[model samples]
Target chain A: MRYKVRELTDMQNSALKEIINIGVGNAATSLSKMIKHQISIDIPELRVEIIEKVPEAAGGADKVVSGVIMHVDGDINGYIMMLLSEDSAATICKAINEEEDTDIHTPMNQSMLEEIGHILAGSYISSLAEFLTLDVKISPPMQTFDMLGAIMDQILIEMSQNVECTLFFDTVFVLEGKQMEGILLTLFDPMGMDKLLGRIDEMT
Target chain B: MIIVGMADSAVAKKPEKLTTLGLGSCIGISLYDNRNCIGGMVHIMLPSVENARAKDNRAKFADTGIPDLVDSMVKQGAAKHHLTAKIAGGARMFSFSSNSNLNIGERNLAATKEVLDKLRIKTIADDTGDTYGRTIILDTETGQLTVKSAQKGEKRY
Candidate 1:
């Protein structure tokens, strides 16, 4: 059945938010420990947007950003993405390598960013699976620096063929109290959304 | 400047710059008539609308969108035969993309070319098939197409 975003009850929405909040909080904690620095996150904001609007909703289409994306498979199918500004990527690299002139474009730096994304996603997905009682695994990470809209358009296109709405959420993070900030986004297909809502219903 | 979003299209005359931003695995086709100084741009995600369940947005597919753009420009006083096409922004984005995500950029570009060929529209320029994203802008006054990328330097055709 095609699930419309407006049809979701407030109870389901809040429950989904609470689950996402816990998952993001756990991921944030993992990153903070890895960097050995404090990490603060904005409230996790969720949305159900048409596939085409996803790029604009995440940020401006043309805005350049560093992105690491991975597909989530198994019981649920979707994508998990990490988007960081150039400065944010630099800072994250600096925190780990503790070196000067952290060029985020270098192959080494790129993989480093991918690893960071993987670890955070691992933590987040684990918590989500544990909470929702669902089985999901993330694919290998793909990292690139490009316009935010371009980076995500391909994924959105892949999603659009089967689903009308993309269920996604964004959580902004600031690391070590610096201006370094990044966003973590999760996008799910309609079937996945239905499965998630079904699991939510069963748990309740 | 009129910004065309993904699965969107726009038609404008001279003095109005038409642009579509951040395209990946999608084709941004710009049609222009130098004599009339009129331009049209479409950001198409899919190659054809034939197989899509939702056909309301003709701008979302290359086959439907390019014709719609041409018709719009022609209606606004531009001659259909005088229209020339410049295209950009069909990139793999991720080199390792596999399975259902395979070479969609190339597919979109190929579909666009097929449609343009059928429409007898000459494609003067194309910057595509790389593993990067591009934003394209069309100058209605001069019919100049500029393709920009974050990693690659800018190019105009």
Candidate 2:
């Protein structure tokens, strides 16, 4: 038995890239407002691939700590996974809360994950909705603190054989003259791709 | 004193030993034996036996962790049928887009309940849902279990 490799067309890829660009821009705006600092986000590097290939493709990070997961449904039905180091997550949270104390042991426990999940997931979903002019509802964020392998294993279990595209962004969150780096993964269904491209075509 | 961490279990035989911690969407199981002055606890992160090979692995799934906890307790004189069970954790941590046949926390909670029922062990207390975290502690010497939640005060059983 053989399985055909599913690939996204160039037009589809470009359209999706534009959508993500808007999404990240919205996320940066939210960050800037929350931290009362100028938060800039770099253009993300996007790739479409099967779910099985995500681990190897994203295997270059030295350490992975906290993970934020959100599922978007409405013209698309796929989950988004964002990975960040503990230090980076602390920084992001500090930026959001505008805390002067940089102590990492601020009892983040689970609230940190929950709040970040809400902000980032909200930004991505809302931006996508506005750009495409569609109504979408985002569920509450769920976070997991584990190694990269464990995080990938959980994603694989939930996703089975479906092909999931991962968007890797080299996020440089600057606040108070400090910088933190993080990665974001946005997974979407093929139906989402069609709707997104359809909306883009209507605009241009 | 109460201690809750990953891959470790405690038994409280004395009433003074009050311990309970939150499980979140993770699965937590408790074991208590009155006569033998023994107790144990196990909290598993995932629901399946497949991810057992990973580094820094716990007792794997509920199926594996349940028996492992039971056997260890029995070796210390905890009778199989006499042991009482109290379980919690297994909340739907996130909503996935696929809607695939994978409800991990629910599956884990179900699997644990099934094992206890098959063994004829009575579950005296339980609090499992898609809510926040849970804290569980067992007194090894007193055979008492205490459950604590972020939203609610501590309860003893």
Which number leads on TM-score?
1
lDDT of 2 by residue, A26-45 (tens): 88788667556676667877
For candidate 2, the TM-score of chain A alone versus the native chain A is 0.78
Say which docking band candidate 2 falls in: incorrect
For candidate 1, list the clashing residue pairs, or say none: none
Which 10-residue window in model 1 chain B sums to the lowest lDDT? B94-103
**Please, what are the lDDT tens digits per residue for candidate 1 over residues A24-108?**
8898899888878888776777788888888888888898999999889877888889999888888888888888867888899
Supply the TM-score for candidate 1.
Answer: 0.96
Instruction: Supply candidate 2's per-residue lDDT for A63.
Output: 34
Q: Candidate 1, residues B6-121: lDDT per residue as tens digits?
A: 89999999899999999888989999999999999999999888888777889999989999999988999999999999999888987544447678899999999999999999
- Top of the candidates by DockQ: 1
Which candidate number has the best lDDT? 1
Candidate 2 wrong stretches, greater than 4 Å: A1-9, A59-62, A94-109, A164-170, A202-204, B1-100, B104-157
